[model samples]
Each structure stands twice: as C-alpha cells, then as structure tokens.
Target: MNLVESEYQMGKSKIFMRESQKQKLDTQLHQTILSRIIVIQRWYRTIHQRRHFLNFRAMVVKIQAKHTAMSI
Candidate 1:
C-alpha cells in the first residue's frame, strides 16, 4: 500500500484513506459480486434447458408408442 502522507491519516487506533481510494474499493467489490451472479445465472439456465429437453423427448416417445400400439 503506497500511502502518501497527504492521502491517508493515522489516528491513535485507526487508519483512514482518501475518497478516491474508497471509491476504487467500492467499484471492485461491486464488479466481483456481479460476476458471481452472472456465473450462477448461466449454470441455472443450462440445467433448466436440459430438463425441458428431456421432458419433450419423453413425450415424443410416448406418442410414438401409442401410434405403434394402435397400428397393431
């Protein structure tokens, strides 16, 4: 941490940074949270789509089975 003397202050038990540093930290935290949310959303969409495809395939199979039984 490059603490310029003017950019920070050291009190008896606390260290304070300038507004610019605080803003930079806030931006980084928000970006990290948003990236994690994107990953979770992508994973959930993949699982939901796969389940929907499986259901559709099962319905098609059932329809084919009924058609074959009627022919027999």
Candidate 2:
C-alpha cells in the first residue's frame, strides 16, 4: 500500500494528524470523518475571528488612550 503525509497550517502554528487508509471506507465511517472535519474547520474559524476582534479592540483602546492624553 502507498502511504502519504500532508501538512495544514492554522494561523502562525503548525498541526499534524496522521490518517491511514488500506481499503475503501464505508459510508458511516466516511460521514463521521467528514463531520469531524467540518467541526474542526468551524472551530478554527471561530478562533481566528476572535483573534482579529481582540486585536481591533486593543487598537481602539490604544487610540482612545492616546486621544485622552493629548486632550489632557
């Protein structure tokens, strides 16, 4: 059997998961894997969005602090 490895990067970090296949996958198994993949994708998106939002909020706070200092 042929074996292969792949890499996927999320944000600035790297993650790896090994997957093996020696024969055809049944529908139930395939469905389970697909659902898990979907869930992981959603989770990653949520994390990335939160990071962006926090960065934006921090920038706003910084700007407000600077403005207040200038006024004083």
Candidate 3:
C-alpha cells in the first residue's frame, strides 16, 4: 500500500498513526525545540555580555575622570 493509505487515518480533529510514525514525529519535534532553545540562549547571552561590557566601560571612564581631576 501507499504511505498515505497505510500510514495514517484521519478523524474529525486528529490523525492516528503507527508507533513508528509517532516516534518519527516526536524526534523531529524534539530537534526543532532544541534548536530554538539554542537560538534563544545565544540571544540572551549576547545581551547579557553587552550589558556587562557597557557597565565596565562606564566604570573605567568614571575612574579616569576622577584621576585626571585629581592630577589637575
């Protein structure tokens, strides 16, 4: 039989398939979820690192200003 004819059945609001088909779909779903999670994590890390760098730069500038004022 063809894949469409043998692999699944359609009900009013759901499609039913064999265990192997379910496993295949589950694996694909997990992979997609993991990839999205990685993207989100990378974005969060970039924002966090950028904020930390800006804070450090501001502190350095403040210290330099104080040192220059004291020397003058």
Candidate 4:
C-alpha cells in the first residue's frame, strides 16, 4: 500500500511487532517531523528577509527626503 496505509498498518500492529520494527517506526516519524520543521523554518526565514529588505528601502527613502528638505 501507500506510505499512509503502511504507517496505519504499523500503528495497528504495534503490539505484535519486534523491538526493531518499533525503532524503525520511531525513526521514520522523527525524520518526518524534522523535515517538516526545516521546511517551516526556511519559509519563515524567507518572509523575514523580504520584510527586512522592504523596511530598509523605506528607511532609505525617508532619509533622502529629509536631506532634500534640509537642502531646500
């Protein structure tokens, strides 16, 4: 079957499996969680980078306008 179905079967068979099977399942679960967390962190990093760039641009514009006003 599929990954989901396989995982479901593993869950249902938990009481019958050997120690090795349990460890394997746990390792798979950990890897899945870690990968998802990495994806989320990368997504947040990109969003923060974009926001920082926009803020920097805004500050630059404000500073230029202030200098122009002072010169006028």
Candidate 5:
C-alpha cells in the first residue's frame, strides 16, 4: 500500500509539472503572435500611407497640367 501511494504521488507531480510547462509555452506563443500582428499592422499602415501620397501627387500633377493647357 505504501509503495502504491508513493507511485501515485509521483505521477501526480509529473502531471502538474507538465501542465505548468504547457501554460508557460502557451503564454510565450501568445506574446509572439501579438508582436507579429503589431509588426504587420505597422507595415500595412506604411503601405497605405505611401499609396495615399502617390494619389495626392498624381492629382496635383493633373491639376497643374490643366492649368497649363488653359493658359495656352
């Protein structure tokens, strides 16, 4: 009976340790994913800004061209 009790305790300890390790791993994974999302969002914002700038520049050029034609 004593040996059986000791074995059970050891098994329980192992299970607890495994669960703790898994929780830590999950937390780390969540943080890494969050960081990646932030980086992607920043990159997307930069691309959007660049596109907007290009569109604004194009409009300015078109407006200038129209003015020149009117002057001629």
Candidate 6:
C-alpha cells in the first residue's frame, strides 16, 4: 500500500491494539510522526528564508534610494 494507506492502517490498528502491544505501535507511530514533523519544519524554514531574503533586498533598495536622494 501507499504511504497514506499505510498511515491510515497504522492509525486504526493503534486504536485497537492492547496496552502491551501499544508500545511497539507507538514506536512505529513516533518514527512516522517525527519524519513528517521534520518535513514540515524544513518547509517552513525554506519559506521563512525566502521571506527574509526578500525583506533584505527591499531594505537595500530603500537605503540606496536614500543615499541617491542625499547626493542629488
């Protein structure tokens, strides 16, 4: 099965698993959760980095304009 199906299956199994068996499932679930968390974190980091770069460019343009105005 694909990733989505596997995740769904694991989730359903987790709800029905006995307490003793839960630990094993918990480990598997944690791995999946951690990986997904990393993906999300990386995505947000990229977005923030791009925004920072754009803001820096805008600031540079404003500073250059101010200097040009002072010179003229």
Per-candidate local distance difference test: 0.89, 0.71, 0.89, 0.79, 0.76, 0.76
Clashing pairs in 4: none
How far in Å is the alpha carbon of 3 misplaced in model 1?
8.8
TM-score per candidate: 0.75, 0.62, 0.86, 0.69, 0.67, 0.60
lDDT digits (tens) for residues 26-55 of candidate 5: 788899999999999999999999999999
Off by over 4 Å in 5: 1-17
**Model 4 TM-score, 2 decimals:** 0.69
Clashes of 5: 0
Give per-residue CA lDDT, model 6, range 2-67, as digits (tens): 123333334544544345455666778899999999999999999999999999999999999999
How does candidate 6 score on lDDT? 0.76
* Candidates 2 and 6 compared by TM-score, better number: 2
TM-score of 5: 0.67
lDDT of 6 at 51: 100
Q: What is the Å distance of residue 61 in model 1 from its true position?
A: 0.8
lDDT of 1 by residue, 1-72 (tens): 444678778899997989987776788889999999999999999999999999999999999999999999
| Runs of candidate 6 exceeding 4 Å displacement | 1-22
lDDT, residue 39, candidate 1: 100
Cα lDDT of candidate 1 equals 0.89
Q: Which regions of candidate 4 are displaced past 4 Å? A: 1-15
Residue-level lDDT tens digits of model 2 in 15-47: 443433322234457888999999999999999
Candidate 5 residue pairs that clash: none
User: How many backbone clashes does every candidate have?
Assistant: 0, 0, 0, 0, 0, 0
In candidate 5 the C-alpha lDDT for residue 37 amounts to 100
Clashes in predicted model 4:
0
Give residue 71's lDDT in candidate 2 (0 to 100). Answer: 100
